[model samples]
Target: MYFLVMKMRSSRNILPLLSTMIQRTCKFSALPELTKDRYPNVKRGNYSQIDTKHLNFFKDLLGETRVITDENECLGYNTDWIKANRGYSRCVLKPKSTDEVAAILKFCNENLLAVCPQGGNTGLVGGSVPVFDEIVLSTSLMNRIISLDETSGVLTCEAGCILENLEKYLDEHRLIMPLDLGAKGSCQIGGNVSTNAGGLRLLRYGNLQGTVLGLEAVTANGQILDCMSTLKKDNTGFHLKHLFIGSEGSLGLVTKVSIQCPPKPKAVNLAFLGLESFDKILMVFKRCKHELGEILSSCEAIDADSLAATTDNLNLKSPLEKFPFYMVIETHGSDNGHDEEKLNRFLSSLMEDGTVEDGIATNEPSKMNAVWQLRERITEGLIHDGYVFKYDLSLPLENFYSLVGIMKERVGKDAVRVSGYGHVGDGNVHLNVAVKEFSADVLNKIEPFIYEYTSKLRGSISAEHGIGFRKTKYMHYSKSKEAIDLMKSIKKMMDPKGILNPYKVLPQ
Candidate 1:
């Protein structure tokens, strides 16, 4: 299904067709089921258990080659990124500044020890791994960048950089990084500002709580709190870096950020559309926000079992020719002949009122990265199509894709696939569910019945993926027990020996 596309401008023909364009394993064939043995009532948080004098104080404060007590190099920081949580983390450490992550969180909060705070682990839910053996603390050697005002585009970096290497170092100062993802080549802008990561230009340079603008974190007693403010006007006091953006490292440990970057768009365009239902994908997203106004950026929404789970598990090909729903639409501008004459006068008014039924438009960048690798690699092809679960919702784009058709009829026929894709201009919908294997009666019919139909349509059961460790018991189905008891009294006042990241995002 050509997910949202457009390029028809004819009396006969006027040209608008251009196209072109990971065996990064672990979808678990075995050896995954260990997120504290698949959440057996989550226990184990008494802390302090790294032994050998706390591994000789993290091998004498990050030495012995940045510590990592081998177990096959700490099993890739105790696994994640769609292995469905398997953290064991027996020492990983690496630290490369920010005062060595505040001397390993003030010596793991005076040796109560728990830690976790990894980056580039590319978290999906099990927030940067490490559950029962918490002691990872990596930041991939705090990949610095530290500052690049570019006459006020603002950027600061660290917290192990790498979010497509700061978008190619802010594309040589033309600037960007107002967020965009599909795990930006291995994610990490301090885990995208501790999971405030809303990608694909967050429907035009938005979210990351308004593109960051400050951060420093490090709490659990090792104190570092600098609000790093690169300023977009800080009215000061009580913006305490919004207590670590999305708070998945549980109240602190971010280590440095400072965003607000957006300049790199001197005209770009793309369209890949075909639709039949979902009310023509909300009447072509309200005529692409009033006819590609301000050169829209990303709109994405896909279905057709999420592009047949990326052509039956990642072989990737689908360009156009199947319409049960799809839309990709994108645009960013500064003028390419007025952004291709406002995307060819908004695809000649959707081919004279056809609501973009079929199309393909491009401005070539390898044909717009071959149509954004068909919507950012459909979650690595639904984790190679099987036993996946995913979810990151946010709904209310008219009840967004209606819970992927009520989860394909409440997972009818015991699911081998019940799909959906995301960021339809920020209503966020990465809902997925595959299963050629692994099932506890289809994960008990999709958890809390899809968080009670997304809290009866109030919607937002972990939108940009943050109440980690697999949706921290659906966090009161989207908060409000006085906002989760004021987020557990600010995680017991900045991790009072809860020792950071333990059992993740509170809710225990």
Candidate 2:
């Protein structure tokens, strides 16, 4: 037996890859089937459809350039990132300021017209797009940075600011956004806050619930609710900002956001390891916490099938030789020497016990990023494989990988491949199933089974991805009847008419 470690050549940033993915998602052969037709059970609400009067009102308020009625241009805004959901909205409104958003929502509410608050249109579920003829209220034009307190690192920016753009701006000031995602290239800050996005860095920096300080939202009636508090500790009557944090834009449209950023780490390091089994991966995670402790920024596990998908579909080469499992571990700290030493020691201990079959460690920016691409680009690569059924789950580590094997057995031969990968540090697992094409029979075998099994193990069916249009029916598995009822009450109170993002998040 021989030990084989990999050393990869330096490459440019991840922009080329991100650009390719964005291009692929934008070009559609023909528009996807309308949501209303795809799921006939979902009846359109008794709301006024967009008429000439409505379009004229919007045109007068925001000028013709701001109000988009051209069908060809509106097509891009009507579909989701995965092209899984498409709406039949004939109009898309681009509001440049909070006052404009307020006016649009207020007018729509008064006219009894339902509206969908859209941002970047990168949502995994069908939450961002309209179901029927709801007017598309887009926030892409509200992009402006209100202010940045260098001392406290509190950044207040309009909701339309892109995530990658925010990170770049923060880098110059020695600070960074607490949460990051693969979709950061195109996902908007407002949408990130609305969905409460938890990405690769949640292992160290925590979720948006802690990172986001406050936000300003407009209700269905168009009332501006400003909860923009910069202070970390605000003992007010109610932390009202939370109501919209993960509401998925069903309650209201997020206009602006205030988030607390952490100082950028002076040093960073990554270790890519090859493992033999799931039990060994668990053992490594426990030892990892004990050894790496405070410096560990991320710990991700990708199975052989997942790695193959990236290499085969995306033409990306694996750094190391074939292995049953692969792990990407990263650390961020103030001292370079100290952090690298800790990581090296941790890898040494695992290798001594043969827990890690092979490994490569580095602090070089380009090489580290090249490895990061392997993990971040998995979602994009799988799309090229076939029709993908994605599940975001959180389960006890003891049985984390059990469901993947169970699914492969359950789906049998219809499935082209069943792969699992995600943040092990936090217990969120992304299980993706790829088939040649969509089949109701395959879907029937997958869905209720995945949710039921997750409930049986006392796991969350939706770990970080909030309950959007796709998972509304499965809410019962995760929430009690009382909980769901209470949620409905809150929806009624916040958005009485259900004008904002109808047929999403809440079950009928």
Candidate 3:
């Protein structure tokens, strides 16, 4: 297979053929049926159904084009990114401005109608979609850049602004957003904040809690809470914006965001290296941090099985010889000459000390992107392999790769592929298991075992992905009863009627 892939790489036509084969191999003929019955405990709240009066109110508030009633058109809103969950939302409301959102939510609160605030619909968990007949309030149409203070590097934009578009705008201003993800093209800044999305740049720029200066969100009662302060250091009272940062829209509907953008780096470099084992990978990471210092932006790792899955599914050849583990180290600095020199020295030291088996480093933009594709596209390639059971965890670096081995042994023949990869610099590992399809027996073998191992190691079960509907039941595995009780109290106080996103984040 490797030789075939190498040969195909030599020709352009074969690449397209491989792509078509992959599409066919990964395509799902029909998604698993998802209904309220799947979650036996979550019965529909006693909320009023959408009637002509509600339709007229929405139509009058946001024109006929913005209010969608057609079931076919609402399909996109009803399905999640992984297609693991489905909803039956009958109406999708697109509000253009904060006032429009406020009006809609106010009416919904008065009428006892449940509302699901959606943006981009690119979330892994089923947080953005409705579970039953809740109204889908989409921010897709509210995408507008409101302000950018180039000197201060502060950006204030509508919550619906696409992340990639924000990055492009920042490129013009010689700045960049603190976050970068594979779904940046479709994920909205508002949604990013709502979920506290931490992507590739998280190792360097930190998470949304620090990057987001302020934001304006509408509560369940349609009251717009104005916390949109662009100031970097405002010692104001409660610092309420932090409440909504990772609340998953169960608290409020984020309408606008004020984020602090860091100046874009002048020089960027990436080093893709093949390591003999996880120990070697860890040694390289420690040495890289000591050597690269401030310029180190990202340090990620992928196991051999993950690389093979990616190569087979996407027809992407490994840049180096196959190994048990691979690390993609990146550097960002102000001077190209200094950055290149630092990266080269680090690579030379690793090779000389036998820390790295084989590697390739490049500063070229196109080549850098190609190297990143190997790491960023793993999630995309895994979807084709089979039904993927994904767990994003933050563990002690020593125990990061242990679970993959354990799961492989437990699942035995039932598992097709058990792969591990993620931002190793931040101790976050994405462990994915691919099987032929969803199986109750297979799940029983994996779940409590994996979560128990994670909890015993004193690690977080959810590193970046919020506890959407998927992980709501497992919250106890990571958090304490007291902590969960406090969270429930907050949720109750903020959204007393449970009109906000139901059965998400805090478990019922």
Candidate 4:
């Protein structure tokens, strides 16, 4: 009986071992092999590699426990959020304070070592991860809320604080951060400020450039430039904080941020409308603006392809019959009764005029959230559909949905799905093309042509997502030579060694 029991226990252990082996093999095999060689223009810099002395210096600066040298632990930092970009960094340095960040940059600069400053590592572009063996200076441990003023609604916090945590903290005080995104749970405020992330709330609160009152950043030479102000109005010289707002960490590393937070609305209402065409979507947006007015916090649009993908992947049925286009309009106000009255009135007018095929409006928290899930879950669903080539652009309102059709015709059979959805309130459309896998031929058909189409319309190639390495070569599509030259000059002046986020934001 004892022998039999031993045999069973051994069998159980062996089964798990076999399972683990199979998982590890599959995981490793699934990992895409993209190295610096793929980007032939980005040659390794002259910066020295990590050595024992360098490791000891970091260990001494930020205790041994904070320096992660294990290859497995560093893997998470080396890979981007989309798993499209991978790096080969050997170590990740987690610093707890602004002083630690300053000291690390100083040491790396003096040692001629390349460094990549990382926040929550939630960036969609390849900006957060390193291309080669650059040491990762992570701000994950520097998360601390410095202060919150109940009177002025100004909240100051460290750079690494998660967006959702900040929102929760503000909820207790009846305030709301001016930004909201799908990745709020994992994306850090520093990265948001770095990328100038414009999410669902931008249509209501404006961009971060206006909401961010002040910032504190560390230069490549280790100088701590502190402009941390909490005042709503400041006529400071040059407004240096604006430089780092959307710089994408190419010039300096943002260590602290002071932003203007608005009061949390007491009542929130959402209307999910199914329309027959993009023309109706635009008409609804204008009517909502005129009717809902100040209470209209968000006006987002989704095409049939996007809705179909969301329904297929999430298994969530649309509240109304599927149409060629869908619009999710949200209203926020101090009184639920007034907000709902306005939303209902607008919906009634739309339905009576035959502008909307079907629609649903709800103020109950559960039902309202169910409506939002359809729009917010589109990004997650796209990942499962296949590899997504996402393009966020600002175009003339009339020319917004045209590009999606143009691209569909261009790619034809190569693309599995071509969908369009975005913040229609602000004229930003997220054009996503899903394919079974990445293909150079597909990319060639989409590029220069799309940029040309947007440029001719006098629209921006990148609306919210910054010009990371992926879009560096296309800067000319949106900016003039003189503008790009000034950017290059500023980069050279700030980081002479080009050690901070090398081969990014600017073309080679």
lDDT of 1 by residue, 1-508 (tens): 1223444433334233222223324354565778777778889977777888878877887779898788888988898867888877778888898887887788888988888888888888888888778888888878889779898898887878888888898899898788778778887888878878788777777888877888888788878888888989889668878768888778778878888888999888787776668777887888889988678988888877787666556656666666678788888998787877787777667767876666777787886787688788887777765568888888889877777777878788877678887887878888888776678788888888998888988888888878777777778887878988887887888777788887877678
Expressed as tens digits, the lDDT of each residue in 348-406 for candidate 4 is: 87877788766677777777777677888787777766677889899988888999999
lDDT of 1 at 360: 72
Error of 3 at 321 (Å): 2.4
- Candidate 2 has a TM-score of 0.94
**Tens digits of per-residue lDDT for model 2, 339-440:** 877888788878776788777888888788778888988877787666778899999888788889999998999988899999888898999888766667
RMSD of 1: 18.3
lDDT, model 4, position 28: 20
- RMSD from true fold, candidate 4: 10.6
Task: Return the TM-score for candidate 3, rounded to 2 decimals.
Answer: 0.94
lDDT of 3 at 482: 100
Query: Residue 426: error of model 4 in Å?
Result: 0.5
Global lDDT scores for all candidate models:
0.79, 0.86, 0.86, 0.84
The predicted structure with the larger TM-score, 1 or 4, is 4
Q: Write the per-residue lDDT of candidate 3 for residues 1-508, one digit (tens) a residue.
A: 0011111121123221123234427754356556475565677888899899999988988889999999889888988877667888889999889999999888998999999899998887788888887899999988999999988999999999999999999999999999999898899999999999999978899999999999999999999999999999999799999999999999999999999999999988888887789999999989887889999999999998887776778887666766789898988899988988888888887877778777778887877887788888888888877777888899999998999999999999998889999988999999988887877798889987888899999999899988888788889989999999999999989888889988789877
TM-score of each: 0.37, 0.94, 0.94, 0.93
- Backbone clashes in candidate 1 total 11
